[model samples]
Target: MLIPLVLLTALAVFRTAGALGVRRFDGWRVSAAHAMAVMLLFTAGAHFAPPSVTVMPNSADLTAMVPPQIPFPELVVYGTGVLELAGAAGLVLPATRRAAAVCLALLFALMFPANAYAALNGVELAGDAPSPLVPRALEQVLYIATVTWVAWPARTRPHPAAPGRDADRATGAGRRS
Candidate 1:
């Protein structure tokens, strides 16, 4: 949504301004990785929110997105929430970042059905006004693009190693065999 777009853009700017570290953010990859991870985690947390609250799409709404044939739509939401959390964590780690991005990208693709249903049905998400079909479509496209940015090969490793960390890599003294 617009929230993620703005957040990611702000992060990229901060990185470019040298607030994040010495090695600047590579515009999309690093920025998207961190920003999307945060966004995922945010959304995942909403799944556990009380039903009385309307901060996110209601369970009934989400359930409606599932085909009637699916036995338990609530389970789907819960499961996807867990998956998003795991994926979010993966996005922040070096070894798993790329793999996570791939899976999250696929998840975004797989999630389209619900999104389409919402758009067509005029379902507002996160208390936001119902997004028009064109905007909804554009959002999907942006989601894919953000995932691509997150999944893209790191142009400059996204971020530099922590202070003294790169040196450790050179010596291997801190590592155990």
Candidate 2:
């Protein structure tokens, strides 16, 4: 929950900055891509991070957040971790950004059930209780919406150094014998 909030806040800042003339992040899609990439990477690291003495749990502790109805909760946690990491990596590339965003949005939607179970049944992580149900649900909704927005394509812009541009020319890759 905290992570998602941070990501959303970061997105807001990026958007505001872009509006104020930060051309690099001038588009919502680009901002979303950057936000999701960073956020997902941060969360993904938890899957392999060392155990802590806080409310937040280690990767294995994620099983506790999953409802009992779901078999192999731990595996789900690991799978989600890999998915998030892959999504983050894919989000950076212009060719795969949209597909990755859509997939990540779907992943977020599917994750709501686990979050709901956590709230309804008092799911805890390393002694850390989940946020209230209403807020958790609301956050999940907003998260999914934000992820969906990331699927929107940024306007195309060829890099300054492309195959026939600066870098490729210097590297001679664009020059055919």
Q: Of the candidates shown, which would achieve the greatest lDDT relative to the real structure?
A: 2
Q: How far out, in Å, is residue 9 in model 1?
A: 5.4
lDDT for model 2 comes to: 0.79
Pick by TM-score: which candidate is best? 2
- After superposition, which runs of candidate 2 have C-alpha atoms over 4 Å from their true positions? 12-23, 52-55, 153-177
Per-residue accuracy of model 2 over 117-153 as CA lDDT, tens digit each: 8888887766776668898788777767766777774
How far in Å is the alpha carbon of 59 misplaced in model 1? 3.5
**C-alpha TM-score for every candidate:** 0.71, 0.74
lDDT of 2 at 116: 83
lDDT of 1 by residue, 1-177 (tens): 655675566566746755556454544567667777777877777666666667666555566566555677799888888888999899878688878878887888887777777778767665676666676667767766776776767445434545476768876858988
Give the clashing residue pairs of candidate 1, or none: none
